[model samples]
Target: MSTPVEQAFRDHWGRVLAALIGFLGDFERAEEAAQEAFAIAAERWPRDGAPDHPAAWLLTTGRNRAINRIRRERALAAKLPLLEPPRPQADQPAIPDERLELIFTCCHPALAVEAQVALTLRTLGGLTTEQIARAFLVPEATMAQRLVRAKRKVKAAGIPFRVPEGETLRERLGGVLAVVYLIFNAGYSAPPAQGELAAEAIRLGRALAELLPAEAEAHGLLALMVLHDARHDARVREGELVLLADQDRSLWDAERLAEGRALLERALALGGRGPYVVQAAIAALHAQDPPDWPQLAALYGELARLTGSPVVELNRAIAVAEAEGPAAGLALADALPLERFHYLHATRGELLGRLGRDAEARDAYRRALALVHDDAERRLLERRLAALG
Candidate 1:
């Protein structure tokens, strides 16, 4: 349908605009130029047939439009340079390659964590302001203002518009990967049941992996997302959550599972050790063709040792449940500040359910239900409570 085509066009527009802005060193003018380029495409593509390299066409046309506009504006009125004394015509900033420089500038560490994530989504990730706002639970107006401020800061700070070399490349790449994983996590942890989790996460994950093929952890993270997402259908009942223990294994996406395994295999081959690699290793065990409970348990243990995070501990508890018993998982779950997160109690309830502690399980479910804001999560917890009743 035209909807998919329109969506694709918008996605390309954002990417090309961002790339061209990186090229021109003028964020404000980029969208106008990209739009003009698209207007040409819309007329030409339908009549003369689509071009061979449509994206490249868009980028080239947009840059040309930007240059023409700059020339026209300059001809209209002579303006003094704000940053420096009048420069010789020969002394001008060199335009860097678009895509690489764009990535580096957006990933700059000076921005707040939230701003960095938002900028990447707005630029390379090709997501709309509304989509980004909803994802972060911020008001659309607030997000718009935040983005405006971020762009202004980018211009004012005179952030270098080029990819770094060596040590600098390593540092910038860390922020880049962090943003990708942040987006992935946002999509992955969507209620752990339903409402467009896998599809949304996979969309961004695929983008990240494609954008940075040499970055092994990116592939590993995508594999991890794919592996977990493959279980979406099996993750819940009709509308209620079916714990990992009770999930129907037959319902898992076998094709996705295979893809995830293959991706992890590639990641392991690359041998880039990082948080993502470790997480992928944990996910890899869950996605084993046969689902090796003991191996999966061991992987979680290793992950906990590396991260030492309470969230990881909570996850490790789930893995321990498969290897040892519910009592062990419950004991592990109990040793932390689980009240801050509803999932912690939800998981504890599942382990308690397995331990034949129906009353305690019911209590855990009730507590979790109270903390949950989503309707589906509330319904799931109610169903669990009713089962206990």
Candidate 2:
């Protein structure tokens, strides 16, 4: 249902913006110019037809817009030094994919981790402030302020707009990987055909793995995403959510699964035992004909110890329920400090239902329904609640 211009925007927004940033060396100005270019494209492309190379056209248009703006503000132009434009090369990509550099700049340790992830989503993932805000479950105004502060910090601290080298790369890599994974999670959680964020995240993961071929976590992250994404088609059916246990395995993408397994093998071969590697190993096990519940519970326990996150503990509880029993999982879940998290209640509901505690299960399901927002999830919870009667 999207116009050609809108489709082009979705495909090339990040690349065009990255090129503009590399040219103008200012995030605000680069964004302004990119918007201007897209605005122009929306108007003109509809009538005149899209250019042969949309990205190249957009980048050139944005660059010219920036130059024109500088010319108009003579005092500002005089006060600020600009890089000389690089000569055009025939062999160069239409719009150079400088997103890696942009992401590194956004994820610099100088900024807070939340800001780093938010800023990367904005600048390199082409996500709107509202989209990023919703992903983080924060108000739009709060997210706007956070983004403003992050950009200001980047400018004030003069974070270099280039990928780091040597020890610095190793130091910054964790933040970058985390940002990419969060982006993936946001996309993965969305309803089917809602956005290209998951594919975009996988693309970024591929870039990271290629950029750091020896970095086991990079490969692990890529493997993790691909493995999970392989089940995208089977995750939903007939406009309803599908649990992994009930999903049609025939719907899963074999190619992606194979690629994921190969990548996991590569990561393990490289001595990966980090959080991502552990998660990748878990995902691989999930793909098996019959999952190893005991081994899975053990791996989740290891992950819980490595991350010390309550959410990870919650996942471990579920695995324990499968490996041990519902009472065991309920015992662990009841002690967690995640009173406000709906998933905890949802998990309790499922485990309680399995144990034939109808009344308690209904209460937990209702509690989850109260907190849940997504239509697909809400419907699932409602069905489960009704089944108790």
Candidate 3:
């Protein structure tokens, strides 16, 4: 079992790094300094006992270490003249929370979407380059280069290390939320053996919601994550994927589901009708016994209109099937331009099987099996194909 101090380090690593970056105004330097501080903590905490406020201690230590390193490097000192050492003083006022600022900076529109997501996972989510690369199915060196380039652009282009306001915040908020969802999806879709990217994303979502409590979309995103992750325990069994309907409902986290419902209610009350809110509402419907599939289909239709996403439409088709019949769902799925999407084919296969078109269903399942990446999903498809005989 990990010690409390060790757990605190894992939880607050991003916060400490964000604070250091704000103080030092250099991404690489801040990360290095934060790492050094944690290294020191590893050595000293066992001897000195853990501090009452580990995050604050880590931030202060990281800042001091950064200042000293700058002092020692004459070239670095010349480059960063504004980073003069702080004078010893009595308890200073608390540093403002800079994690939001850091995330906004990472998700700047100037960066590509992939880079923005990768950088956010690294800087704000505290994921290593290798871990992020693995999550995205990219090579380690490629991810490392991507992070390097992102940081270089941030420095060279002088992206402001502060949160935007008004219209700017509105424009940038979408990218940040997209990146968070991407992180969650990565964790949600990965094999059971991988890390919990979903939990990390949910934690980040909670932080974003707390930081911008008035932002309905933030709450919506958090609700969506909480609702989806509540099913994490039920999503798989015996190392195989388990469809939602087939999952043992008892395995679902009741507290998380309740929390998600409360968040959805709060978001709706805030007059949020955005895509995330709509999706969360759909998830809320699913949590119900004898789900309101008509309402779910309607919400998905609204989401499809808001986002113009074929995936949402495909989901809507599934809802339509549940509300109407498999044939209606198959018709909707057939019209979609998702030939390469494995889930689309898998869904079609199920609908076809339900309609007793075994031959077509078997072919559809084969197509899905060919395109599917996850072994568990592929196995499910294979089983469906075999059932056709």
Candidate 4:
């Protein structure tokens, strides 16, 4: 179990950092002050007990630290206008939650997509550079350089620390949503130690939906993530990965599943026919006792048309196999240019096994096993390969 201060840091890191950035108007400085405040909290809170309002306390502490650093550096000529006398704790003003603004700033259209994702995960998701690198399968130094270049771009381009307006908001919404979903995916498949990323992404999704109630895709994305997360406990058994069809329904989070369904309804009512909405619908279907494979295949088909993603097409093939037959699905999968994708080979292996083509199935499973990385997934593939004997 985490200490109270540790929990508070997780809960408030983004808010405090966002508040500091708004105050200091510099990402690096804001991040450094937030880290210093958390360091102070880690040292003092255990000895003195946690603050009554930890987020507020962290914000004030971080702001003071930043201000003091500015004064010490004598860069007052440049930052003097932004500085203010630190208020006593008794008279501290209520800090507005500026995480939404911070995320928009991080995800500015002026920045590259990868940079926007790295910056948002760093500032808003509060993930360390190493953690972000692990999630993206990149070297730590590479991720760090990306972050540095991103911050420099933000500074040089003078991207405003505010959400865009009107059509601009709509245009920018896609990138923001993509970043949030990428964070969720990172957490979803992350090692157990890093699973908190998924929860953090959901928290961000909830905030995005609440702050932009009119954005159907935001609600759709939240619904998709929540529905999948509802089955998190059932996705693995012991130390092995569990296929969705074999998962124990009793292990599912009933309340979260209901919430996902409600959110899906809300998105659909808002006339959301976007890719995220379609994917949420598929997740909702998967929660059923026996999923409607035909409906799922149709949804995947629609999603493929919308996104033009081969991954979606691969998923469609799986659904088609369930609804139609192995031959039909295998034909679709074979036509795709995804030979290097392990999941494709795995799916083909399953389809071939069902067709009694043991040799081809073995070859397919071997290909999948060669590309598989996750321990649980690798174990599952190994079991499948052995069963072919």
Candidate 5:
């Protein structure tokens, strides 16, 4: 029921903001100008009708607004030394799509991981501070401060607002991929309240994949997200969480699954077998009916080796349980230092339950319930605990 103008604004806000930041070379000023342009559009669009290229219109308006604001406020003007006048109509493209540069800037290695994720969601994902905070289960005020500090750091450090090249790009690409996947996971794991975030993250991933088609990890990340998102419908049922093995396959999105498979194939074809690619391959295996557990276990072994992540080892334990036995899986799980991760406990509970170690399983489920924050996941752990009784 949303209007075309609303839809356009939602879709193009990041591109407009990215172009503005590239032009203005100041995040605060660029954001303010972009917001002002949107405000004007909110008033004018209903009357003038939406423009053929709404993003282009927004970029032009935002640039003009920044120029006017700079001229009016001397104090503000001093901070920005290189304000260029609005280019003549024929001299410039409608809107320069510099989102890649914007993403790299937001995901700079100098920034903390949390700040990188927050700033990328805000600037490139067009997510509100409140939305980002809610997604991460943090306070709005705290998230706002984090964003402010990150922006100030970018300016103070003079982090270039352009994409890096050669080895530099390779060095920075990991951070960028991590930020994108974090956004996707935030959206994927939360309940319906933040479902749109998952879709937004996927859109960002698709854009990244298209922009850097040669990068195997980019394609791997996109495939991983798409494959995982394909199960969104099956992940929940009648307001309750559904375990993967119990999910109704009919509810899984076929198109998204196919898309993910195709992307995985492409990434593999590129001969890039990074952690993301291996993870995507694991996800693809899971999408199968009676998933190839032996293959999944092998892939998880590769993944754990690639990332040296205890979480991946925990996942590998699950696959090992299926391919071998619950006792074997429990042995592997016990070796991991995953005391703080809720899923580890949950997996341990499931494995112990399968092995008829009900008392230990009950204890694991209780621990998981205490650690888990999500309502659905807590409910699931409680259900498991109740089943033991």
Candidate 6:
């Protein structure tokens, strides 16, 4: 059974950590202080039965711990930066302006975008490096190295860890959006080893939406995460990738689908849009359907217009095939980036098999299967290849 205090601790740590950084004005020290607070909680909380306001208690304890460390080191008169009040001491439970600044600092353009996403997931969302790596489909070692390099760069540059003002905001917004989307993408595309990386991304996106409610892009992202996650349970069979058409719509998460549709509606109403919102609008159509391929096709058309990304075009091609017929999808998919891309080849192979192009489909499936890692995906590709034989 999951303990409430442990749940609260994990859920609230990101925001509390953010607030601490805002107050302390340094990432490394703020993390140390937060760690100390957790240690204290482990020792005292069970006896005290969880303070009425756990977040405040944690924050207060963390800040106090920082002070003790400063004093113990005899830096009391050395003129160090004091912890600025991040949110009122007793009233609102939200983080202060400093937390916002911290977001901006992490979202800084100087940091590689992968590093930005990885760091945000780690520090802001409390995800481990292994989690981040799995989401990105990279090795854990590579992700760890990337994160270490990013931290070193941030320290070396001495980039002020705070939110940016109006003029600079637009320039930084792209990077911020990219990082957020990167997290979402990782969750959306998790390996079989993880229960639901997609769920993790949605959680992070939802948190960001809460922290920045007025930001249309944030809602757009939330909308997208929910829509994708809705299909997760039925997207695969007993160790096989069930193509969308083959998936059992009855198994889709209805509640999450409804919630995602509502978020997309709100996101669309916000109007001041970007690629994520536009892509979400496309996904919203999918979220509402019992696999109505035509509606999905229209959405793909809209999305293709929003961002001419090759990936989007590839998706659009698939949508076109779904709305029309396998022949149409095959032509479109073939013309796109099909080479060295497992999904493209796998898709084309499936289409060709339907078209009675047995030899060609078998070859395509072989190539596609060679590139795929997930067991379920591999099984499906092999099944298709066997069927062709």
> Which candidate should be chosen as best, given TM-score against the real structure?
3
Ranking by TM-score: 3, 5, 4, 6, 1, 2
Estimate the TM-score of every prediction: 0.82, 0.77, 0.92, 0.86, 0.90, 0.86
Quality of model 3 by C-alpha lDDT: 0.88
Per-residue CA lDDT of model 5 for 160-232, tens digit only, reads 9988999999889988998888878878877778887788888888889888889999999999999999988
lDDT value, residue 26 of candidate 5: 88
Indicate the residue-level lDDT of 82 in model 2.
Answer: 68
Per-residue lDDT tens digits for candidate 3, residues 181-226, read: 9888888888753446887899899999999898899999999999
Better of 4 and 5 by TM-score: 5
Candidate 1 lDDT by residue in tens digits, 41-78 = 87777777765556666777777777677667884244
TM-score for candidate 6, residues paired by index: 0.86
Residues 1-389, candidate 2, lDDT per residue (tens digit)?
Answer: 99988888877887789878888888998999999999999999989998878888888888888888887887565634665664563244456778778888988888998898788778776778998787677999999999999988888889999988898887788889988888788789886443466887897798789867899999999999999999998998998999888989999999999999999999999999999999999999898888898899899999999999999899889988988999999999999999888889999999999999999999999999889988999999898889889
Candidates 3 and 4 compared by TM-score, better number: 3
Clashing pairs in 4: none
Which regions of candidate 4 are displaced past 4 Å?
A: 1-4, 39-52, 83-93, 112-114, 130-145, 357-360, 366-375
What TM-score does structure 1 among the candidates reach? 0.82
Each model's lDDT comes to 0.73, 0.87, 0.88, 0.90, 0.89, 0.75
lDDT tens digits, residue span 1-389, model 6? 76656776667777778878767766777888988887788888788777777787788888888878877888877735564433445444543434456667777889877788887877777777897787677999999898888777777898777667676866676677677667666555555665455555666677667767777888888887788788888886775678776788899989988988889888878874677787777776665555567776776767777776666767777787777888998888888855777988888887888888888888888899889987877887887788786
Residue-level lDDT of model 4, residues 1-389, one tens digit each, is 99988898778888889888887888999999999999999999989988888888888888888888888999989888876666666345477788888989998888988898889889987889998888787999999999999998888889988878998898788889988898888889877766877987898899899888988999999999999999999988887889998899999999999999999999999999997899999999999978999999999999999999999999999999999999999999999999888999999999999999999999999999999887889999999989899
Candidate 5 worst ten-residue window by lDDT: 85-94
lDDT of residue 202 for candidate 5: 86
Return whichever of 2 and 6 wins on lDDT: 2
How far out, in Å, is residue 139 in model 1?
3.7
Rank order (by lDDT, best first): 4, 5, 3, 2, 6, 1
Task: Kindly report which residue stretches of model 1 are placed more than 4 angstroms away from their true locations once superposed.
Answer: 2-11, 75-97, 134-137, 188-211, 248-251
